[model samples]
Target: MTATDGIRVVTLAGEIDHDTGDTLRHALDATGESCPRIVIDMGQVTFMDSSGINILIAAHRALSEAGGWLRLAAPARNVMRTIHIVGIDALIDCRETLSQALSD
Candidate 1:
């Protein structure tokens, strides 16, 4: 886990489903208190399910309510396609890379 500025960059690889969704949630929850921004680097993520989307949405909502932000970085094609199809891309900021996300 590399960080840029104050944002935590969690680089995730492999599938994001029910099994791994909890890990994502826990990670977000753990940082919710101190971090004002979270950047999930999905450049290596090959797959994502509805549960994974739900996790992201939950994290976004939690962070937003706390005056923070949750951004998605470098999602693979499949994940990006799902995000677009589900219209979550409009709710959360999705960038091409971690650098782009950090800059934003």
Candidate 2:
């Protein structure tokens, strides 16, 4: 993970599922004390399941309620489709590019 202009860019790869949910939950959210602005770089994420969706929703709600936000950037079609099917795209900003996500 890296930070750009006060926003965190977390680049995720491989698959996100029940097996990886705990680690991902911690990685996406390190400190609950501060409001966090983050962009998830999903260009390399190949698959995601309900566990992944739950983690994302938890992160989004935490960030939003704390005056911050979360964005999903450049997710693969499969991953993006999962997000769309679950309506997570409506709760978080989904961008087509990393540049757009950072700027937004």
Candidate 3:
């Protein structure tokens, strides 16, 4: 994870399933900074399941309640399809590029 202009950019690769859900939650939500704004770089993420969706939902809610927000950036084709099908792209700010997400 790296912070870019106060927006934390977390890069995750590989499949995100039940096995990795808790870890993903921690990586995304275990922030000590108040009002943490984060952009998840999903460009490298190959796949994701419902567990990943749940974790994202929880993190989005937590961040929003804390006056922050979550953005998804550059998801792979398959992952993007899943995100769209699940309606997560609507709930979360999804960008086509990491730079776009950071700027947003």
- Number of the top TM-score candidate: 3
> Which candidate order results from sorting by lDDT in descending order?
3, 2, 1
Clashes of each: 0, 0, 0
Better candidate number, 2 or 3, judged by lDDT: 3
- C-alpha lDDT values of all predictions: 0.87, 0.90, 0.91
The runs of at least 3 residues in candidate 1 whose Cα sits more than 4 Å from the true structure, single-residue gaps closed, are: 30-35
Candidate 2, run of 10 with poorest lDDT: 27-36
Error in Å for residue 25 of model 1: 0.8
Candidate 2, residues 1-104: lDDT per residue as tens digits? Answer: 99999899899999999999988898887476577899999999999999999999999988888889999999999888889989999889999999999994
Which residue pairs collide, candidate 3?
A: none
Off by over 4 Å in 3: none
Q: In model 2, where do residues sit more than 4 Å from their true spots?
A: 30-33
Q: Estimate each model's TM-score.
A: 0.92, 0.94, 0.95
- Mind giving the per-residue lDDT tens digits that candidate 3 earns over 27-57? 8974677888999999989989999999999
Report the Cα lDDT for residue 1, model 1: 74
